[model samples]
Target: MAAQFATEAGDEPMNNALWRYALQVYSRPGVESLLLRLQDEFDADILQILAVLWANETALRISDEALNAPDYLAWRESMIQPLRDRRRACQRGEHGDLYELLKKAELEAERYGLGLLWTVLKDSPAASENCGLQGLMLLCNSEKECRELLQLAQP
Candidate 1:
């Protein structure tokens, strides 16, 4: 996230929007409530981290039936109003997490002394299009973040 991961080793700036959007999506209707109840800062950095976890987790839940429903896609779109870009990037590709992609990407980056590499993950990017498990990651994240999101849904 922009806050936590915002700074590189030298401490430069990155896209705060990604972090902000991350929280917006990460919080969702119920999750945000939990974070708020705990008095957590609604900043972008933490939110982005949460969003990343949420997006990755949700992408893993889609099934063939869910893939064919328009209404389902719409609902998913609604909940994930923010974090759309990162969510899409994570989602794109095949149906499996290709360790090869991650390895290749990371390797490619390191080739230039970039010292950075992100393995290409095989994802269908299905969630970006507005279908599949809507806000499905509404359940996954660090245990603490999960508890907060869960609390947000309290009656």
Candidate 2:
């Protein structure tokens, strides 16, 4: 984990840490795939939380091949019961409560051969040019991040 993530935490901001952690988790293999699957199959609460983190996710994906091959929807069905059971359910206004969010996301990403999550984040049009450095930082904690991210995602 240390080798995969950035050690020096300069004035980058909270999102930088989030991205650093995300990339480490993605490079671990199986983690991205599982998380992707969890995104679709998990629950709305989980999906909403993911949507929030994804809003500011800056972990740059190191692998290009892994980019076009994210088949998470398929893996969700096979995830262990304990993992699924852990899936969080959020109410509509209950968007910004994702402190332990990484646990589930990490578990899923580790389950798949996914790599370079931040790069995947690049796919988002909102992140264009901006790199979402601030957005990621501000929303590093709960639905506040999700709400902000969602606003950023919106046209």
Candidate 3:
């Protein structure tokens, strides 16, 4: 399913660990809807949530400093959100080609943001405790919804 969004080989950002992890997880059934729900209901940053899950999966601990990725935040605010708003606006209209272009641009911007997050988090310490999905709740609004997302990650 996620393959539908795949870019051609040699596209920038495909080599990043976070990008690969995100694609793998997002390809799972039910994962995409749950993620979109998290985004829409909580206004959560999907990349940050993915980063936290990636950290937990790889036994890494996300520090407060790493989470405060100023460059990524600035880029998301300036580039991603406006594109998302415009793309969504097209969803309510008939601008099909424009919508597709905006969607692609939004995804590329997100990939760039993920690279920034990886730079900050790549050196994080290993997790000494099992702070997995529970840790994600801190970045979400509703624990129940987060738990729902967590279930999809479980084997």
Candidate 4:
């Protein structure tokens, strides 16, 4: 699948860009647990958080109007959320294999959703020359929490 989006022989495919971004960011120390906590406790959208991080890192901005766009919302509700629910539902069950499969599906759905989001924001202007961080800060309930998360995202 990665080959489908590759521009050069050794390049990472743009098709899996979001997945790759997610993997790199999530692998940062303390990030995975922090994201999970935010999701489980605050009902936060992990994909949205990731989108914000990606935008900030890439010197792009996702406008509120784009984030609330009807088509994106529809896709999230129809495609991403259901897979996430199914994956989470299997967490407490004895079906380890099924759980893993659902987890993979959910991640795929998230990557697809992110791709759709990127398409929407592709031509949008950058928030600033310095790469604004406010988009990601807004994802958290408090400044302190947002600060912590942002720190983790730092290279």
| Each model's backbone clash number | 13, 22, 0, 0
Give the per-residue lDDT of model 4 (tens digit) for 1-155. Answer: 32222222332323645456667889999998988888887777787787777666666667777666677688889988898888777864699899988888877777777777766655568666533356755665755666677789766
Tell me, by lDDT, which candidate is best: 3
Score candidate 4 by lDDT: 0.69
- Per-residue lDDT over 73-149 for candidate 3, one digit per residue giving the tens place of the 0 to 100 score: 89889999999998998963578889999999999888888888877776677789766666687678788877777
Ranking by lDDT: 3, 4, 2, 1
Off by over 4 Å in 1: 1-13, 20-23, 39-45, 48-155
Can you tell me which runs of candidate 4 are displaced by over 4 Å? Answer: 1-16, 91-93, 129-132
lDDT per residue (tens digit) for residues 121-155 in model 1: 11334344422123323223345654455344322
Give the winner by lDDT: 1 or 2.
Answer: 2
lDDT of each: 0.34, 0.38, 0.77, 0.69
TM-scores for every candidate against the unseen true structure: 0.23, 0.28, 0.86, 0.81
How many pairs of residues in model 3 come into backbone collision? 0
Residue ranges of candidate 2 with Cα displaced over 4 Å: 1-42, 45-48, 51-70, 80-145, 148-155
Model 2 residue 5 lDDT score: 36
The alpha-carbon lDDT assigned to residue 154 of candidate 1 equals 28
Better of 3 and 4 by TM-score: 3
Report the poorest 10 consecutive residues by lDDT, candidate 2.
60-69
